[model samples]
Target: MSKKNNKIYLDFAATTPVDREVLKVMMPYFSEKFGNASSTHSFGQEAIAAVDKARETIAQCFNCDFSEIIFTGSATEANNLAILGIVKNVQKFHIISTKIEHESVLEPLKELEKSGHEITYLTVDKTGLIKIADLEKAIKDNTILISVIYANNEIGTIQPIKEIGKLLEKINKKRKEGGLSKIYLHTDAVQAINYLECRPDWLKIDLLTFSGHKIYGPKGIGGLYIRKNSPLSPIIFGGGQEFGLRSGTENVASIVGLAKAVESAFNNKVKNFKKVSDLRNQMLADIIKHSGESAKLNGSPKSCLPNILSIRFSGLSNETLIVALDRAGVAVSAGAACSSRALAVSHVLIAIGLTPKQVKESIRISLGKDITAREIKMATEIINKTIQNLL
Candidate 1:
């Protein structure tokens, strides 16, 4: 729990404060070392070198070639690039994604539908896990891409990406034998990158997208890993930067900060995973102890990311609880921060079979690496007490 002037931030899924080390390394590039990476002069050369190093760092972290990693403005942009980029200029095709995907992926898929592309929106079980059989059945001959969220942002239920990837690999081999176009597998790993296996071989994915801010890096920078031969066209065309796939002047400072943050987080993944999960488990137990029958935890605990908890308190309002918690100096959310502004119930919760009334009763409490046990204890008390007061 990080409290400044009595405020505890529990919304790590939305974004994270930039790590101190990442900030330290980014300082020079913002001032003395600033330069346009596209320029041909020494300043530009220096800036481009930093960019290359950042790319190399990401490649090493995700176990991909340097050329396969493409930096973007945000994970939203990366998701757009991976989804729209692959099927660009094609006559017609099909794609598959989950009902629980972030708007970044869902919106693009929706747009593709307007352009005559077929999309299959797979449903999830009560625990928010997609069925592999459903996905296997959704494949059409022209199905070129399948984009799934590696871990849902709201409920934090991790989809079986490895199983899906292996299924694709086998299907692709037979498709090759049959002379059909390859069906690329893309996972929006923005939420899963911090706590899951991301190696391309391990997941058997053709494309993976993640955000910098989600892992304690600065905002405005994200990364995409494209397999060596994936056919992706540029959605943003300008100066032909980023190996001609994403064209724009590189954001040197955020790029370096992203790399440093990713390297640090990826290296400390096991330790951080255990610590955050332990804190979250303890907090869950405490919250459940108090709320008991009134509280219902929304997703599979075993399959979740350990940091995120979506819970509903019977007969209480999420909006009211959110206000009460905020007044008490604890920050939380009703659902994905991206969709928090909307009045409608979360599409994610609905897909998992939550009623509109239950959706209004639910709130999300996500933990960060900086959170301490004391903070969790305080937060648990505050949350339960707030519900009692509301009741």
Candidate 2:
């Protein structure tokens, strides 16, 4: 196979190319239907209708009311709104979160800590899963919220969301009986929508965050699901769009694109997941067969996102391997794209007990729905050759 024939994209976790169908649905909103959703005139009403329809479609996916969906500029913004908004009215309360969360959630918690709220950063096992008992111990009478990432971005280990939700439900019942404030659960499900079950009712989470681009939709659009009566205040104050939570003129085109993406994702979820997972399995088997003892799979062998494969090579640098793969027309990542520039040891890796050297030797290969068997085989061959060259 010619290396130049196709560019093997294995960085789906960073972002996915917008689906052509989704783009087609969004085109009219950009030019012909370009109107401010907040306006009341004809053009504006048309835009608002599109926005409402998108909200309803997404809400259906999450099993939430249309009014509960709050569209934001990005998943990072949704995470911030969920974390900061929940603590807006409280003066001093405790919050619980895992150390492996995305920075959007971590940074907001840090801000809350600075404002006198007690924050507990829970530790995870080597598999990147938190202990329910530990979480229970951490909850105090003043604990207000618990935020956890549904699926780890780099490692792909899925948390026990349903169990955590059930635990919280029991705890909330006790709190209500004691006349104490109920602790709410929020999950950043940006990486889970395509592969995992995310209905708010099923997960039993009070608040949730999602990004459009991660699911093959347009960039710069995301949504937050707030269960009715969930205690949250507005983080952004303005024209009071998005039910007074996220205020700004809506990104009508992107919202339309997001709805189309969500619809497509659910419509073909099973088929897409099975195909990508089979490809991932083939890639892993090939790497192990070719590289032997030098290769080691990171994260849980089971209970991981089918699309993500985090692998470590002993005595090799991840950056060098990534560069070599890119030169061979295969794209991959060292970790989250947002933190790639820092060149520091990944906190998620370190938290999972990887030594600094092992962390440096790890790379993340995420598969997309469009990937083919031929591309997987070609990429694996390129990776094996690159490793040999680097060694």
Candidate 3:
């Protein structure tokens, strides 16, 4: 716990250490290009140009038109705006979301519930995948929106989003025949953006959300991709920035850094994919080989994200293991960083049918671009040894 023993950071899913190149790009903007983008002066015009360029870069990364991406304070804000914005103009007071959504999506849905809107929390399979059949059955006459995460944050399982999109499209076509308005589909791609293949337009995603910090960029800057002509309302009222969908002055430095970080991530995606996946499997193999039958993985090995490994130790609480690992110079997350303090069982695990005991025993270990295979072996050895001693 001391400064000298902070340990190797292995919790990339929670957040990554800023990439050095990204920091280099962000440094000059803090003072040199520091101008309110709304001003009419030359400095302001330069800032505006920088922000516009960043927006175009982000759109290109997502394979969407420049006008569709609305930068926000974070993906949390983007989720709020995407979900709440669509619901604001709707007479139908119903929404559908998964139980595994981050607090950002869940909190806004709760607020809508408080306003007397009906929201269905869908269940996922053991692999943390939502069944399309279940989704179809959950659809109601008043259901106006369906917001599912593209990939889970804790277990890192990628959802069947393309299939879900096709289903929604079918529903929309039927609605058109019935002379009824179609339900909108939104996906929180916050965890999926940099790690996997993501083409929002091809996936038929109406609104997609992701964060800058999650992808090794500056914090306090993220975005929502809104398909053109979508019904939405701005939650924040201000100087009509981001085409009046999101209000306020832009975080120019962070925006520029985010665009650059995203570009870097995409450029390294294929190489990182094989490297991280190999590291992830090696870590899992080590844990299983060393920890014996007590070790249990929470999600499907093949379907989960390449960078994340969620494992549970029988008779070991995550808090205990976290402290043990921290003392041994390894850093791993207990669960979603946001809910670690509440000591609640991860909603993600619970939704996937993990028992309460399994939930408490679980920890999420996410690898970064910089983590080496040797480091992974050491981390797993520490985990296995610590669990043996503790048990």
TM-score of each: 0.99, 0.98, 0.97
RMSD vs true structure, all candidates: 0.9, 1.6, 1.9
Which pairs clash (backbone N, Cα, C closer than 3 Å) in model 3? none
Full-model lDDT for every candidate: 0.92, 0.91, 0.87
Poorest 10 consecutive residues by lDDT, candidate 3: 1-10
Off by over 4 Å in 3: 1-6
Off by over 4 Å in 1: none
Each candidate's clash count: 2, 0, 0
Name the better of 1 and 2 by TM-score.
1
Q: Of the pair 1 and 3, which is ahead by lDDT?
A: 1
The reply for model 2, stretches above 4 Å from the true place, is: 1-5
Model 3 scores a C-alpha lDDT of: 0.87
- Residue range 1-391, candidate 1, lDDT tens digits: 3776898989899999999999999999989999999999999999999999999999999888999999999999999999989988677899999999999999999998988789999999999999999999999998999999999999999999999998998999999999999999999999887888888879999999989999999999999999998999999999999999999889999999999998988898888899999999998998889888999999888999979999999999999899899999899999898878875699999999999999999999999988998888888888888888888
Among these predicted structures, which one has the highest lDDT? 1
In terms of TM-score, how similar is model 3 to the real structure? Answer: 0.97
Query: Can you write out model 2's per-residue Cα lDDT over 1-391, one digit (the tens) per residue?
Result: 2224577889999999999999999999978999898888999999999999999998887778999998999999999999999988887899999999998999899988888789999999888889999999999999999999999999999999999999999989989999999899999999999988889999999999999999999999998999999888988888999888888989999999999998888778899889989999999999999899999988887889999999999999999989888988899999998999998788999999899999999999999988889889888898999999888
Tens-digit lDDT track of model 3 for 257-373:
999988888788888888989989988988888878988898878887898999988889899889888988888887898998788778899988988988989999999888876
Winning model by TM-score: 1
